[model samples]
Target chain A: MEAETFTLILDLMGTFAFALNGGLTAVRAARVDLVGVITLGMITAMGGGILRDMMLNVQPATFQDWRYLAVAAAGAFIAFAFSWVLHRMAIPIEILDAIGLSVFAVAGAIKAMNFGFGPVQSMILGTVTAVGGGTIRDVLILRVPSVLSEGLYAIPAFVGAALTVAALELELNGVAAAILGASVCWLIRVVGVYFKLNAPRPPRVEPGNLQG
Target chain B: MEAETFTLILDLMGTFAFALNGGLTAVRAARVDLVGVITLGMITAMGGGILRDMMLNVQPATFQDWRYLAVAAAGAFIAFAFSWVLHRMAIPIEILDAIGLSVFAVAGAIKAMNFGFGPVQSMILGTVTAVGGGTIRDVLILRVPSVLSEGLYAIPAFVGAALTVAALELELNGVAAAILGASVCWLIRVVGVYFKLNAPRPPRVEPGNLQG
Candidate 1:
């Protein structure tokens, strides 16, 4: 029970952070007004969980817990109220993106596993959790999804989730499993960025490039 | 075979018209430019079928019929080129909206029934089909869904589809059925607009109501 409460707090914090990042992105990209900023922020934080819950035929996690709304609203409020100062700050956007990625991966995998998903399904859930919100945000804002177009995005979460589910089957407790899971995901992601571990690309097949 | 070809042509025309409508809405909203118009147009035309297929665990209908893409692209092109003239024309938007609604409703119901869904499922499909494209477009544009919030949108389609399916059961043929289905939907929609039939508003919980 205590662990669940702690996890929920972490989840809410992650949501707030994600919302802040979304608001900042919206302002930078499309110059959204305050209402638009809040809407985008809320969507970026809660969109994936909503998708997961709807697909799984469960009540949406955000709707079930008022804390989710509070987190998102608070984040949006802060971002809207302090746009000038925050915009001038040297805060790295990538850090917020990383935090969003890690928290969502953990939350999504846990939710899926709780619903009795197998390791493969759990991994997919984790990937969805990590990237789904941003995907929705981009589509709504009429931008190509960053996940599909750039970066080594989904693979790390997939690997981390598979490891977490695997460790659980081997009888590890929750905290240790989370630390291990997050470590695997975070290490690979951080290293991949620094070292530029390129995702494989299928070269474009132009008509002139076709061989007989 | 000839009848199938005819239906196919009409379907493409209907798709083109709706795609244009979607593009015009975005342009009116002025959130994006050429790219935005095309993207929204494609989504509006194909979004319903995409949602249905995703829910049914099938590959999307647009993937099966590349003509959908052709029609969408053409519609977007026409809208982009002629938007200024169209916007200036004295023609009412309601006529085009009603036509789009009816066509989408019939298409959705037919597709669902053909896919072996029962009546209730078909009804659900009909409702989604008629308004799903518009709903998604509005969401992307960050406007309240016109269907869900200010109009007698979904209900008219629902009624029209029920009549069409019932007619089908009674051995009504293609031309007669299509006419009846479309007319029924359009008449209801026009009536709704003229007389303002809509769902009751949520209570006045919004702030600043007292200021007025």
Candidate 2:
């Protein structure tokens, strides 16, 4: 497959993953009606991309492209309908969430680079794109965002973004580059979760009560 | 002053108001370091404008302009330095917040109209611009955003945006029109606070509360 097509597919997959994650979170957060559930789901799916576009001084791709909206809506609807089942499938949800984070980080970085941003800026934007929606989701549900408080979350995204940027710099902007970037991110995230690894915390400060 | 200058002044004032509001909220929310406070303040001040620009498919004005950043940063710094006094000055902070909401709503609507969006779209963008940052701030602090939960918040913004759009439609896009739109929004918001007026809630549902 063409590199662009591959990246696009990954982006769509990530969007679907985030939509499910967001919908499930909404179900857990409140006794919100259908509007609330769908709203939260859409926000979770598209919020990061919107923010990334704003930072890059471009129109949000999700708004311009119908596919993104359709996939996100479908994913959200499915999650909402299967809330009972999803509520009991925490491990699977976590795995999907990690995949979403990995692919989004790489895709966001590549997009930033395509927009002529430098590597550092691209990496930052990539990480933001990966985690921004979940941050927004956590906030809406009245919890401190895991990015700031939790273990090994932002780090994996940063690593993925950096790898993508490095690959582009090495003239490796192909499927191999994308796979390498995403694999590093996903593997680290999964291992981190399995081992309960944490990023360094502040000296002697009590950890936040929220789980990662 | 030229109408453009008048609108610019109001936009800057709104940025300052949101910065203070966001900074103060951060101070109250957690034992965040200085970076956290300033980051939250800037997001609160600029998030609306960024969202507006995205809807209009243009670069955010805040990113292109330095004055907005400076004003927002100053407001945040002041709030951080004087958290004790600001914490006790809740009434004043609220008034400033109302001013911010009104001006942002009007400015956003006008800008969207200038960019050639239809009236309905302009009004929605305007209201989003007014409340978007505060919504982000609330989420960051892990609270349900005031726009979604509180009384008369989104209403004032919508009213201001509608007035601004109406003014443009009536060919009254001048200082008088700007003043009219902003004043109406500010007055209603201040009055809403005084009377404790709430926007219509979903019937009979207990408000989900997390301590402010």
Candidate 3:
């Protein structure tokens, strides 16, 4: 498969995953009606890409292309319709979310490079594309963004973006490169979730134990 | 003053307003450290313009220029240093926020028009530029976005953007047109706050009134 086609397929799948993730979160956390559910889902799926494109000085594909919107809407509606089943399958949702994260990170980085950004910028944008939507969704639902508090979130994304950049520099076949980058990201994320890994936290200070 | 200069001034003021508004909200609502306060402030100040630029398919001015960042940072630091006094002065903050909203609405619309978008697109982007940052800020603090639930948010922005488009069509002086558009929005928002106005809510449903 061509690299462009591969990236599109992975991106669409990632978008679907995030849409479901956002929709389910809204259903579980808020008293919003159907409009809210679909709206949150679309935002979750597309927000990161939109942010990435804006930084890259290009029109967001979400606004320009109808396919992205249609796919995201489908994901939201499906989640809403199957809320009962989804509610009972928390682990599956988490794994799907991880897949979305990895795909977006690699695709976002590739897109940034295509737009002529440097590797550092590509890596940053890749991470942003992976995590940006969830951050926005969390904020809309009035929660501290998990990106700021959660374990091993951005690390996998950065690594995946780096790998993609390296593959491109080496002129590897596009499909294989994308797959390798995404797989590395997916593995790290799955391990993090399964192991309940946490990034380092600030040291705890005991009350009334200030050192002189 | 040239229209360009006027627009720049208004945009800067709007940036400052949002930064202060965001920082003050953080101080009032969250137990975040200083870094949190500053980060929230910058996001609030810049989020709207970034959203607007993304929709317009242009580089976000916030990312391209340092002035916006410097102003937003100053606003955040000032808010942090005087949060105690600000907490006691809620009305002032609200007024400043209204100013920010009006200015950004007009500026964003004008920018869209400059970028060759249609009037409707300009109006939408304008409103997004006005309210987008605050929406992000509200979400970050774990609160329902006031724009969706509260007093006359999108309305004033729409009207302001429409007015700016109308002025441009009529070949009005740019500075005068901008001032007029922003003033109208500011007035409507101020009145809404003072009168405790709200958009229409869904009809109340009685709990436990299940019909067979």
Model 2 agreement with the true structure over B78-197: per-residue lDDT tens digits: 877778667778898899889899999888888888888899998999899999998877778777787888789889889988987888789984566767888999999999999999
Clashes of each: 0, 2, 2
Over A1-212, each residue of candidate 2 has an lDDT whose tens digit, in order, gives 87678768878888998999899888888777788778788888899988898788777889998999999998889888999988888888889889899998988888888887777767878988988888877777766776655567778888989997898899984567778888999999999899988654322212564343
lDDT of 1 by residue, B1-212 (tens): 68688667767866787788888888888668889999888888778767656544467777798899999888877777788887875246567767778877877777767776666556556766777787798878887556644667877888878877777768888567766887899899888888877644322223586566
lDDT string for model 1 (A1-212, tens) is 78778777778877987788777666666635554566677778988887776566664567445578778878876766666567765245555556667767877887898998887888788889877887887766667877786677777777777777788878899777876776777777777766767677887888876863
Task: Give the Cα-based TM-score of candidate 3 against the true structure.
Answer: 0.61
Identify the candidate with maximal DockQ: 3
Candidate 3 lDDT tens digits, B72-162:
9999988889998888888988898898999999999999889877676677679889888888887777778777555777778889988
DockQ, each predicted model: 0.04, 0.14, 0.18
DockQ of candidate 3 relative to the true structure: 0.18
What are the runs in model 2 whose C-alpha is more than 4 Å off?
A: A1-110, A116-124, A136-142, A150-212, B1-6, B29-39, B66-82, B140-142, B199-212
Cα RMSD, each candidate: 11.6, 8.0, 7.0
Clashing pairs in 1: none
Could you estimate the TM-score for every candidate?
0.54, 0.61, 0.61
lDDT of 3 by residue, A25-75 (tens): 877776555555766788889989988987887777675556787889999
Docking class of 2: incorrect
Error of 3 at B195 (Å): 12
